[model samples]
Target: MLRAIIVDDEELSVKRLKRLLSESKDIETCHTFMNPLEAYEYAKSSPVDVAFLDISMPELDGMALSGLLLDLDNAMDIVFVTGHDEYALQAFDASALDYLLKPVTAERLDKTLAKIRKNRGYTAAEPALSVFLFNGLRLCRSRKGQETIRLRSPKTEELFAFLMFRRAISREEIVDTLWSDLETDKALKNLNSTLYYIRKAIGSGQTGDCIEAGRHEIRIAESSLYCDLYEFERLLKQIRSAPEPSADLFKRAEVLYTGEFLKGKSYEWASEQTRRLEQDYIELLEAAARFHIGIHQPQQSLRYFCEILKLDAIREDISHEVIRLYTELGRKHEAFQQYRLLEQSLQQELGTRPDPRVEDFIMKLMR
Candidate 1:
C-alpha cells in the first residue's frame, strides 16, 4: 500500500489521477495540493509517500518545491507529473524520484508510484495557505490585520483570486461585480486601471493573461498560485468527512469565516455565492458548537453560539439553550436576564415577539 499526495495546478489532471488512484486498493490519497508552496508546507507537516507533482505554480514551482522538500526530507523523492517534456531532465537533475509526463498513462504512473513505494522507508520534513473586486465601483477589501500582497485588495489581487476561484470570471461579470451600471468604455478603462494597480501591488505582470480578462470571460492564470478559499474549502471537506473535536474543528471554522467573506465590499450581495457563504458561516458556527458540546465542554458551545449570535440574532433556540446551561449551572438570575435581553432585542429589531417556545420558556421561568 502507498500513501500519496497529488500536486497539480490543473483540476482535470488532479481529477484523473484521483480517479485512477482510487481504483487501486493499495493506495490512500493523503492530500492533494495545487500550489508548490502549500505542498512544501504540508509536506513538512504531514507524511507523504509519493508526490505526483507539476513543475510550475505560484509562490513556488515543482522544481523549487522538489528541492526544498528534498532538503526538508532527504529521503522524500519527487515524481514530477506535468505536460511539458522539457522539464524532465531538470526533474531528474533535481534528483527527483522521477519525471512522468501528464495525460499520465496507467502503466507509467504505476511504475513511478511503485518506485516511490519501494523507497517508502524514508522520512522527510516540510513546512506550512483572497480577494474581491467590484467594478469602476472597484471595492477592495484589505485584511483587517495584515497587508500581505496576496491578502491585500489590489485590483490584481481581486482579479487573480477571482479567476482562480471561478476558474474564470467574465469581463462582464467583473464589470458587474465592480461596476455593473457603468458604460462599456468606462468599465474597460476602470478594469484596466485596476489590473495595473494589482500588477503594481503584487509585482509587474504577475497576473497577466493567466487571469484571462477577455471580452466574455476572465479566468485565473491556469499556472498561477492557488487560492486560499479553495484550500480553505478543501480543509472544510476534510474536517466534515473526518469530524473530529480538536485542532481541525477550530482551524476549519476559522478558515471558513475568512473575515466575513470578502469583507468591506457591497457588490452583488444577492449572488448565489454571497448567499452560500452566509449559510456556510452560520453552519460552521453550529458545527463548532456541536464539536465543543461532544467534547464535554459546554463553555465552548456557549462561546460558539455567541459568535453565531453576532451574525444572526434570530436563533432564539441557541440563545435559550445557552441560557438553560447557565441556569442549570446555578445561574438562574443570569438566565432570566438573558431572556429579558433577547426579548428586548427582538422587539427593537423585528417589531415582533419571541417564538412561542421561547415565550413559554420565559413564562415558566418568570413563575
Candidate 2:
C-alpha cells in the first residue's frame, strides 16, 4: 500500500478526497492536516510515499510545502491539488510528479497515481511478502502468475519475528531474548549465523535488505516488509479515529483480524502483544456491535456481540448486550440461553452471580 498524507485547509475537501482515496483502496492515508506547516513537520518524522497537497491555503501554500517536504525526503513523491489552473506550471516547477486541478475526479486521480507509480518504479503486480502471525507463523511471497515462495526456518524465522516485533534491537538484547542459555561469544556467533540463514531463507533480493544489522544493533526496515499484525493494528487505529464509523470500514477491519496474534506460539515476548491485540480485537467487535445497534441492525449487532462473547465470555456487559439484541430480534429463547451461559460462566470462573443490571434486564425481559 502507498503511504500518503493529505493536506487541505478545507475540511470538506479533505473528506471528499479521503473518500475517493478510500474507494481506490491503494493509498493509505497516514495523516491529514489542515495546516501545511503541521503536515511538513509530520512528513519530516514519518516515511511518506506521497504527499497530496492543496495549493491555496494560507500561511503556507502547497508549492512551498512541497519544497520543504522534498528537502526533508528527496525520495518522497508530491502531487499538487489546486483550484487554480494557472498554478500547473508552478507545481511542475516545484518538482511535483503531477498537478491536479481542484474538484479532483477519480479518473484524474487514477491517472496521476499511474504516473507516480511508473515514475517511482512501483509495479502494482509485484509480488508482496505476506507474513501470517494470526494462526501460526507462516511466510509467503505471492505474485499474480508466479508460484508462491514459502519461507521456512525455525531459528531464522524466530529471529526475523523478534526483530519485526521490536523494530530494532541491540545484539545483546537479541542474544538475551533468543539465545539466553548460550555463552556470550557463542550467542553472538549464533545470532550472526541465524541472521544469515534468515536472509537466505527469505530471499536476499528484497527481504535481505529488510533486516539491517550494524555492529551493535539490528532493525527490521518497516517500509521493506509487510506483516498482518502491522496492518491489523493500523486498521484498528483507523476505525477508532474515524469521524463517522461505517459498516464497510468496520467490516474491512474486522476481516483483517483473523485470530489472536500468533495464536499457537508460546514465545515469551509475544505473549504480551498477543494479549493486547486480543483485547483490541474484542473491543473492535464491541464497537461494531454498538454501531450496528445504533443503526437499528439487531441481527448484525447480535453477530458481533456473539463474537465478542466467544473471545471474552466473562464480559457481563457484552453478555447483556447479546441477550438484549437477541430479545430485540424476538429470539427470546436464544436470549435466555445466552443468559444461562453467562450465569454459568460467571459461577464457574469467578464463583459469583451475574451483575445486578444483567439480572434485572433478564427478569424484565421475561416478564
The local distance difference test score of each candidate is: 0.64, 0.81
TM-scores of the candidates in the order shown: 0.54, 0.71
lDDT at position 139, candidate 2:
72
Note each model's CA RMSD in angstroms: 13.2, 7.6
User: How many pairs in model 1 have backbone atoms within 3 A of each other, for residues 3 or more apart or on separate chains, i.e. clashes?
Assistant: 16
Top-TM-score candidate index: 2
**Residue 353 accuracy (lDDT) in model 1:** 77
Q: What tens-digit string does per-residue lDDT give for candidate 2 at 1-367?
A: 7889999999987887787677444675557899998988887788999999999999998888888898899999998988889998888899999988877765567788888779888666433466667767767675221344444456776787788788889999999999999999999999998888878877778767777889999987655656777767766756665565679768877887888777776789999988888888888888998898888898998899899888888999889888887887899999999999999999999999999989999899889
lDDT of candidate model 2 versus the reference: 0.81
Pick out the ten consecutive residues of candidate 1 with the lowest summed lDDT: 125-134
Predicted structure 1, TM vs. truth: 0.54
lDDT of 1 at 153: 58
